[model samples]
Target: MAYFVTPEELVTSNGVDVRELGTGEQWYEAQPD
Candidate 1:
């Protein structure tokens, strides 16, 4: 079975920054933070 994970859950489980994990995946990266 397949399931989805929320960004918060991902961070809690891996203890990683969402932005760091999404280095090459964040489409909105081009826009200034």
Candidate 2:
């Protein structure tokens, strides 16, 4: 499966910015902006 953050994780606006976890071999589910 492709890697990505969940829809719930993307909708929040008041939390600390953090890293997206993954290894380099995986494809992304989205363009990651």
Candidate 3:
């Protein structure tokens, strides 16, 4: 299944602050096992 993440979440996950980049929805695909 596919997954979705917001720009803020993505940035935060990478150790960056969400406020620095703003927020937006983005789609991602699952990797093959």
**Candidate maximizing lDDT:** 1
User: Number of the top candidate by TM-score?
Assistant: 3
RMSD of 2: 9.4
Clashes of each: 0, 0, 0
Q: What stretches of model 2 exceed 4 Å from their correct place?
A: 1-3, 11-33
Candidate 1, residues 1-33: lDDT per residue as tens digits? 222235444332345555565643252333343
lDDT assessment of candidate 3:
0.39
**How well is each residue in 1-33 modelled by candidate 3, as lDDT tens digits?**
323345445433345543454432321322232
RMSD of 3: 6.5
For model 3 the local lDDT of residue 12 reads 34
Candidate 1, which segments miss by more than 4 Å at Cα? 11-33
Q: What lDDT does the true structure give each of the candidates?
A: 0.41, 0.35, 0.39
Candidate 3: Cα lDDT at 6: 59
How do the residues 1-33 of candidate 2 rate in per-residue lDDT, one tens digit apiece? 223444455322334222344322232334354
TM, every model: 0.22, 0.19, 0.25
**On a 0 to 1 TM-score scale, where does candidate 2 land against the true structure?**
0.19
After superposition on all CA atoms, what RMSD does each candidate show versus the true structure? 9.0, 9.4, 6.5
